[model samples]
Target: MVAVLARFLVPLNSLLAAGGARVSAAAESGKARHPLHAMVAKELRLWVATPTYLMNTAVGPALALLAAVSAAVAGPQALASAANVPGVDHDALAGLVSAAFPWVLGLCVAMTPLSASSVSLEGSARWVAQTAPVPSAAIVRSKVAANLLVAVPASLVAGVIASLSLAGGPADAALMVAAPVSCGLLASCLGVLLDARRPRFDWASAYEPVKRSANVAICVGAGVAASFAGGGATLLAGPCAGIAASMAMAALSVLAWKAASRVSLQDR
Candidate 1:
């Protein structure tokens, strides 16, 4: 995994040191948000150029969604034939989707060779982004944007699959769809914040930081706990649960980003 990711990981390190990371002083007064636009564009370009970077997140979720659909298709018939078999009832679907929510979303953002490792991925070359003539906030926001670009669409698809499988009332169905999206928000924020706060610059392989690093574990752990709480609420109170969970995630995400925004990449 590290070798594959290292092949295309941020080939822009040189450009970052050159001029791509540069921003005009008047950019803040302009509509473009200057350096932020440049930084985000650079990250987006990397993904477009190295589509393989996304495979880790994409492959797993695709498989999970396929399994959920297959279960939904064969669930009723199998239950009719073998009463002792595992159930795929609405409640079962709800719990399954809820529990799986953050794990799936974490694939896109928190469990990273990307966002969670964006800073550390720079390795000894961290000076590129740090020396750029832009606020560290611009760099931070760019990472967040890059993460969301993948997470939003991917989470929506997963949620829709869960929603179809659940086949519940409007609120429950909506909750199924909303669950992954909110979890992604929380995961992304925590991933970025934790990585920024404690980065691993010296690594023999990118895989080491991703698996051996504390950021990924903490971020994923928090996501699972928060998501389980939300899922438990759904089990206890159907209607208000999803809304409350989504709102709580959104609020915490903002706070996390706020903390992350204050981090100085140059120092890390």
Candidate 2:
């Protein structure tokens, strides 16, 4: 009976200590906002700086150039032939390119979440957040804003370059800018939620968001799907449909952020 009591008591003590730690951390967080805001900003800068460099300075423009060259060299007939083989109408090749813009937007969406929360989601860093003075919601909001800071412009620029270089339409360019902006906002919020809830702190694997993170896949997939759907609708009508679709996505994303903010602010 004495031995059994000792074993049970040890485990119970450990549990209580852990709970106390979490409670103390929560109390610390209610102390101030500036430090937390700074941390969030720092995380944002660290995350966005690298990707923004690679995408705006490297990949996005490169892809747009390739697409433009392909469109130019192959002309409509080549596109038409490819489309026919795929059973998707040749004219739709133009539509496909138009649709590709939104997918690029998705890439923008994926950046901040992948970068900002990767480190802090785990042990000590997580504790740091717990002790931050800012409301959890503000911290989350800062991260999302950081995503937009990079994504909105980067995606829009990608569209513009793709249009000018690839000979894409104005409408297509608009879709590119709008689609990614919405997707980026949504993805950023989701990333914070994931980080806070199921942090992959112990993960020992390489962190290639494009390859390893489920968030990346989801962000890109949603962006492409939205872009394509919007572009297809635009092809049937005019740019209005694509514009409307982009607007709708943005609206939904705002609602999502608001919902996420509420959750972040709730008592831990």
Candidate 3:
């Protein structure tokens, strides 16, 4: 038993030592940069290197845009028949499209798991981060910001594409943009909070956090619920419903970020 333990412990210790040295060297070199900027850059590099993260971020918006464009090509008659909105008139179909598009875009933005992955990635580097002189709040904020940076832009592009393809007016276009951007921010913040609530540090693969984590299911459920809520709000409140939902989501995001910062600090 002693021999077996030594065999494993010897190499494990060596690897940890090497990793620590590398982390320390990098920290020294980056001392001149703000910790938040450095952390954000690190998270961004990790995301770019991971193909699965890239795919998850891109697929949602791409599919939403494709569906919007296809619906536009199908015309009002097809949309009315599909939606069962009780009228085949241009106005009814246009209203339905305008109302539905924001929900779809918002849901797509919410499906992004970049924030969850950022938290998980930090698990491997928590020791390094703790040893550095950076505050826990900066670390948490950087992770959330990195995910938002990617998710928000992707959602906005999808919103713009959908609005243009569907022939929505300037107001509709603006609402569409705001809905997705706000949803992405909300999703990212919520993801961080959820992960902080139930963090898993023991993982063999990067995919484990985003793909197999319980947080994934929670985030997906939240996205679906928010999408339904947005649709319901639009039905009851008209085209400006998305703006209202965005406002509520923005407030929720601020709260979630505060919670995440607190949770991350405790974990540290």
Candidate 4:
């Protein structure tokens, strides 16, 4: 439990501390606290400084280049064969992929275990944070923001590469990236909620959350849903669906955090 808590808490604390310090420096120098100021402050620093942020940003571009290289070396047919999924219009799919380069950026960031880390971070810092004047919602919001900051660039890079490589229309390409960033934000929020109830790192307790297939299914299902929605022929429905999904996820995350906050107080 201690180890589990440490792993979770240490990273979060470090992130918050670093972010807070930057914010503080700015505030001390001259800036006034803006609305959502604390959250924004934390987010900006983490985006530039965190490993997750860097990884998220890098993965999309790297993968896009690889996909492009593969397309170049193998040719369109080769690219189609590599895809292995039948019935897709090779050119259209390629176009879609190229246009959606930003999605890759989102993907890299979104793929991280945001949910898994939720409890560990909270558990580790619970004593201090709970005692502070800050609201639980504020803490939860900060986490969500931090993850979003990281995931946005990651998704953008990936989506752009995919979009540009495959010849996706500019609008389509933009959505490809935008949808993932929105979804990634939602996922990060959900993670916070999920963490609320997690038992302190007991292998048995941890396994249930870790091994659960529902999270994976939800993400995959979201993609499929987006695809179907896009096929509806409405101008923006598909992208809208992606955005809606992200909002839904974000809502869930908030609910989860609220619940967890209550639980924490009760336990105390």
Q: What is the lDDT of candidate 4?
A: 0.50
Task: Give the candidate order by descending TM-score.
Answer: 3, 1, 2, 4
Predicted candidate 4 versus true structure: per-residue lDDT over 1-268, tens digit per residue: 2344345545766866876788779879998874455655544544434444333333433453454445445544555566667788886655444433334434444455344344443334456555756666666666656656555565565555555544335555556555556556545655555555443433333334334435433543454444344333223344445445445545654665566455452232
Which stretches of model 1 miss by more than 4 angstroms?
1-34, 44-64, 71-113
Once fitted onto the true fold, the runs of candidate 2 whose alpha carbons sit more than 4 angstroms away are 1-37, 45-92, 99-122, 165-170, 205-225, 265-268
User: How far does residue 209 in candidate 2 sit from its true spot (Å)?
Assistant: 9.0
Model 4 deviation from native, Cα RMSD in Å? 7.7
lDDT of 2 by residue, 1-268 (tens): 2344344555655655675576568768885435545555555444433332223223432343344445556654565566565656666665555455455444434433442344333333466656666677776676566655655565555555545544456765566555555555555555555444434455443344324556444544555565556556656766567678667777766765676566542233
TM-score computed on alpha carbons, candidate 4: 0.55
Model 1 poorest 10 in a row by lDDT: 104-113
Better of 3 and 4 by lDDT: 3
Q: Could you tell me the lDDT of residue 108 within candidate 3?
A: 74
All candidates' TM-scores? 0.72, 0.61, 0.78, 0.55
TM-score of decoy 1? 0.72
Candidate achieving the largest TM-score: 3
lDDT of each: 0.63, 0.52, 0.72, 0.50
Residue-level lDDT tens digits of model 3 in 1-268: 2344344554655655675577679878975657687788777766655655555555665565666566557754566667765546766776776667777778877886577656666666768866767776787788789878877777777777667655357667777777778878887888888877777778877778868888877876787787778778876886677678878888998998999888744444
Worst 10 residues of 3 by lDDT: 1-10
